[model samples]
Target: MVKAETVDKAYEIAKERYAEVGVDTEAAMKRLETVPLSLHCWQGDDIHGFLNPEQELTGGIAVTGDYPGVARTPDELTSDLHEALSLIPGKHRVALHMIYAVAKDGKKKDFNDIKPEDFDYWIDWAKKEGIGLDNNGTFFSHPNVKDNMTVASPDKNIRDYWIQHGKLTREVSNYIGEQLGQTCYNNFWVPDGFKDNPIDKLTPRERMLASLDEIEAKDYPEANEQDSFEGKLFGAPGIESFTVGSHEFYQYYAITRQKLWTIDAGHFHPTEDVSDKFASYFPFTKKDLFMHVSRPVRWDSDHTVIVDDALLRITRSLVRDNLLDRTHIGLDFFDATINRVAAWVVGARATQKSLLQAMLAPIDQLKQSEYNADFTTRLIETEELKSMPFGAVWDKFCQDHNVPVGFDWMDNIHQYEKDVQFKRN
Candidate 1:
């Protein structure tokens, strides 16, 4: 089949899927007019030529209608973006996800390695490519970089390493805070806990200490106030040990005692290796971690999964635990098959909705209860108490506002229920 016809056919099929479920793919696509990079969390190491930020469909609504003429090179991609930008309706914009795995020039460290004027030129290039950092001008740091060191290297004791790293990282954060102003700093999530036996590897407590140092760093007094430090659920090359229960709580107390952590939703599944068949073990107190949203396919945990009721209930539990004070819920996602724009909206709407879901609890009464906070906490986590009713109420609430049952509906979520309103800050 000719490539142009093939693209068109895909667009049509996506549209039909949305129609089958009653989504207005056309209007939703309109919401995708301007592409925002922050909405996407996919990063590092791959370089796929940019395509339509509108190359996404959500709630079953297909945004891009198949452009047989779409170009695949960097130059063509930028031109396509310019043309697409013109068609967007109002102040609204489409969302663009960061496809880091497709990094052709190698995971972004070398923008202009050859030219000495790299930094200035790279910023311009970033703007053109619509590239954005989670927070501005932020990068990871370890305690002994001058010595060519790292935070969780195979050589050090877990706790002490964090202590040194935490102090140093905080200093760097101050620098970022002073430079970026209102922008939050971006944090990578490689500090959960460790799995493979590395006797001296850094501990989460130490990691938290370093993170807190960054938050309260003296150089940037407003470090904590300006942007959050995003902590990861897994350490990756190996999972971090400070996951759930008391250890995580230790870090949560220490960090919030200093700043904020954006909890990613899907980190709970660490590459989604769970099986309904076996007893699964989770390491962190789902409540203690302020989360971002992501879902994994089959069992892949780190992949940011789409937000839904099941994920909401977990956040609701945090409110009961009084843990929300230390967390920020961002929509972290990557959908290879869907348009990046649609995925952004879906994740955004879901986080906003989940925040409100916590508000729905009888906050008035909970305040009066003895373990008021404890009661609220139980309201969300005590499995026996929160089941069918919580979900039923939530589903109905979403319906009132115009959220889809799944990714089956397409269009701007025009149906938000009456008392709910979300504003982007």
Candidate 2:
């Protein structure tokens, strides 16, 4: 166990070190506590919703491991989520896919037929936890995903089905927000694309645009419900030619519609850095943005997040621009190869760590150096800031939040698996 006196002493030392660079370590910790991270629920269940546990993961997405303790029912998933939230620091929201809805009296509701009542349990749970909720419209791993086309399908009925689903999801999001007194971000992501190159690309794009128009036509109070759209570069393997909701498509749509466009960290090319997109897209949109933070290797595989340069760069940009309040950050990775709860803790903590590192940086000094054309000083100070006492501050933050500091959370996770997760057959 970390002693309170030790944590305070370490923080005192870190405060003085950051003070030399004009960074207020105490204020940064308080500001970081206000940042709410939306944790994705699919991680607890390997992206298999309660609607049908046996359904094959389609849309060019796949989960490789069959790790035990995967939540099979809504109750089990909720329990796992509670466990994860306890291990993570700060009060956070949970991001849910529409497919995770719990039907009334065991009666199943199709994606389009789902009502806000179906998510009553989630709203109630969030209320009990004193946290907020966000949601997504599930457009993949379903029978309606014909030829990897939904909302962009040539068939009018198929397009209508997904369009209805999108509208219904917004309604549910509004209801959740109203019940919890917090805005629910309803994000849309479609796996509409082609496996190989297609000559007629414009036709499908036009159809998708029309479908999106219909979906967005539903009027919901902006105070309670916020709408956003996500763009993917391509599918897992087969759908490599083009993804209809490519970054370009959603960027244009979001700009014109004056809505949030979600940037998934792993949705772009492996070599391309999404941190650059903030400066590129935020000007045109001129609206609060959304982000689905994930880690990817060679492909769009939703790997667990770590305290890496990419995450630091993304958060650093947000902090420098003073856009953390306007930006909604959500975790989007799920690694079923390890303990699900542990995966959540690792990703959430890594994200928080990156944000702490960013907040501790001397953005004012760096900007002044740049404005004065002293590029040499800016570069040198930026490089030197990397070795600052960030870990000490982070330890204090965790200690203040009453969460396990350093690897102490591992003991809780092991005990949780033994007491709560492993006995489930």
Best by lDDT: 2
Task: Compose the digit string of candidate 1's lDDT tens values, residues 155-218.
Answer: 4563344434344443433433333332334343333344454465446356445544543454
User: Total backbone clashes of model 2?
Assistant: 0
Runs with alpha carbons beyond 4 Å of true place in candidate 2: none
C-alpha lDDT of all candidate models, in order? 0.37, 0.89
- Candidate 2 per-residue C-alpha lDDT over 74-135 given as tens digits, one digit per residue, 9 for 90 to 100: 88999999989998889999999988999877776667778898899998889988899999
Q: What is the lDDT for 179 in model 1?
A: 36
| Model 2, C-alpha of 234: deviation from truth (Å) | 1.1
| Residue 215 displacement (Å), model 2 | 0.7
For candidate 1, give the lDDT of residue 308.
Answer: 59
The best candidate by TM-score is: 2
Off by over 4 Å in 1: 1-38, 41-149, 154-183, 191-196, 199-218, 223-257, 269-290, 296-309, 318-326, 366-425
